[model samples]
Target: MRFIARFCKEKSEYFEIITIYDEHNEKEEISKEHPSIKTITIKNPAGIWFERKMHDDFGIIFEDAFDNRPLVHQERFPKDIHPLRKEFTQTKIEETPYLPYKYEEIDGDGVFQVAVGPIHAGIIEPGHFQFSQAGENMLHLEVRHFYTHKGIEKMLEGKRLEDAKPIVERISGNESIAYQICYRDIYLQATKQELPLSLQKRHALLLEIERTIHHLTDVGFIPNDAGFGSALSFASKLGEEARRKMKEVTGHRFGFGAVSFENSFIDIVAFNEWLNDLDKDIDFFEDWIMDIPSLWDRFDTTGILSLKQAVKYASVGVVARASGVKIDRRENPFYLKHGFSMANEESGDVGARFKVRLKELKNSIEMMRHFLEEDETVLEVAEICDGEYQSFCESSIGELFMSIDIKDGVIERFFARDPSFMNWQAVHIMMQKDIIADFPLINKSCDLSYAGNDL
Candidate 1:
């Protein structure tokens, strides 16, 4: 069962909380206890409960910015109180639960703290990393990131609900289309609208395309870290070609314009041709990587993520799958109807993570081919509508839940939970007992986005 509580303001002294319960009995009990509080019972789409169970442990503890009282949830951390009340301002506070990293002194002779960027030599996003190490061995790594927090949620406030799509698209450039689809689904759900079969097929195809490119770029960096520069170049060329194909269909390299609830610019014949060529190249690339013994030697048994650690941190996506956590949202009946399946690997190491991506890449390609053949027509552009809406999407990375409250076409509240937020902690756990030099390779293997987490 699922439970969601949304805080509302009735007056300064009184707050009205609306709780949505999946079961009628639970809703009745809550309604009876409060008497004045509002409650609703909903039988949500099947399989949502499992997805929620896998990722329901995250919450922030902080002092209410307006009232100066501590605010936090009482679910996972029962001692905490809910701070997301209507009157509470969303501002930084001295007591906010997540603070900048402070490296504790490790007094051994060789142990010292090594601080790295909120900026770096590469063009990657900014995040501060503090390593407490003894010579080459890393004792502990603390990550501090908020440098790229664009106040994305705050930026959506007061804008027309439909107009917020472009802003949501930028939440993570690599996951742009996934974000759009999740937002679109939420809008449709709240408005009680459903897309036609053709549009649903198009949406799935676009999502797979986004997944393919992201994996390509991410996996490419792994070989680069292992000093296989040629593999990196090959992956980059494949990614570039994929993005070029996206431009042909959506008019944007990252697929910003191609996302919608109504239609798409899919040219099935052209896309199939491109997919065939890319498929051959990818197969060859896989074979080439398999032949490289050094790459395998560097990857195997490195950056191990155990099942116990995965459970403790509530890991998701490839990280969780690598550790034998068998929760894959694509197993839902809805995705099955669209011809997709979950991909998994059981080693819980860098090699497993890398193999998981390759397996998913192949799985996505098969889905793309199925979607293209199943629906052979393109869709013309259609206008978007604005209204109150909520949606749950099983994105390539993991499950994403988005909800927007709109009144008179203006957005009031926008909340989203990304997979990156759940998986970032796994990196810290994986870095343990490994040398500082392997940090880059370990990080590339996980590939959790700093921008996604900061937001």
Candidate 2:
């Protein structure tokens, strides 16, 4: 079974560590008297981050873990404090003395290191990347994020379930719709309510639109990073059009509040015309770009993530699909009935990732058109119940997983594992032996979200 997430919840006398997998879930109760448990990293490498995060949050020690370094807490961030403990409810805390983060070092005759950004020149979010290089070739890359960590999960604790929607929607700007859909799914599951087919199609329509816009942006940026400015200009134009259409259909450009049960007013004639135009423009753009040998030269065989590495690290979304992993949550009958088909490539390189995005964008357009034609229906809200629930959605980037525990109509605990959380771990695998100059191109092709991952 594929590993999903591992998180801890505080209890009066103990802490519960819940490990989620694709097929099953396991919970272990660790007595607060001695908060330690056997680590799962030996069998599931992906558990490293989860276990490390649990340690930082709840002071739960994973016995014999390979890497016990703090995941969320920075150096000198008060080693004695565990924020997620039930008793630590202060909104403010004192900072401890500064201590430098210990990044992995490589030693060799000509080895050198390049440190880039927790702050960058561009408008992108903060992340520190340390590259161990020999000449221009990168031997290894160690990425450190969490600078934008907002303590969103902690804030959700004890909040009314109805008031948590806005916070969830804003977790990732580009993935607002996906986050909203997942939140709604969990709420519905907890309340034992099912959405009608019409509403499901409407939700699917919004999700596909979000996916299309993001894919267009990435495909454009990838080419721009490769020095093809024309692709960026054209893709940006198309992306803007899509965003405008999104705002027309749902009052927000990013569809933040569009995932509700009510039917959205879609102008069918205008929508269909836009879809047709997009279809033709995408085809023309693809043909035009494919003829550029130089563009392919930059993209091909650069920043490769092998199929083995993707599977081993549990990579998701385009990163996994490009590497020949046929794992998409959209394979259900609901989506298949709407003309959805999985898009994949096997090269596991920058070129393959680009192709996968293009294919998925086209597929999303087709699916959206079909979903828009579904009949409209009214949805009824169900009373919220005290229970724990989990849900997953295929976000534009990859699989997004959310879990929430409701107690007396308030959120007791909440956790969301964004696709970026998994895909970020596989980035270094793609960078191995590649020249550092191609970092931007490789990074754009993957397009992992910092906000989503950091949260």
Instruction: Tally clashes: model 1.
Output: 3
Positional deviation of residue 382's Cα in model 1 after best superposition, in angstroms = 12
Q: Tens digit of lDDT per residue, candidate 2, span 1-455? A: 78888899887778999998889999989899889999999888878888888898899899989987787899658877888888888898778898887887687999999999989866788998999999999999988888888989989999998899889999999899999999989988987998888888888888988998999999899999999999999999999999998998889898877888788567888899999999999999999989999999999999999898888898888899999999999999988888989999999999999999999989988998898853567777888889889999999999999999998889989999999999988888888869999998898899999999989
Question: What is the C-alpha lDDT profile of model 1 across 1-455, one tens digit per residue?
Answer: 33322323222343333333324222122221232422121222211222221112112111221111211111123233222433435455333354332344456787898888879778899987888898898888866555675656667777876688888988888788878888877766556566777777777788888889888887798889988899889999998988887777678899885676546456788888888888888899889998899999989888999987776666778788878877665676657866676767777888898888888888888888877634444434344345556665656676565667776567766766677766765577787878998888888898877776666
Poorly placed runs, candidate 1 (over 4 Å): 1-101, 104-107, 373-389
Candidate 2: C-alpha RMSD after superposition = 1.1
Best by lDDT: 2
> Ten-residue segment with the worst summed lDDT in candidate 2?
371-380
Model 1: worst 10 consecutive residues (lDDT sum): 65-74
TM-score of 1: 0.78
Candidate 2 regions off by >4 Å?
Answer: 374-376
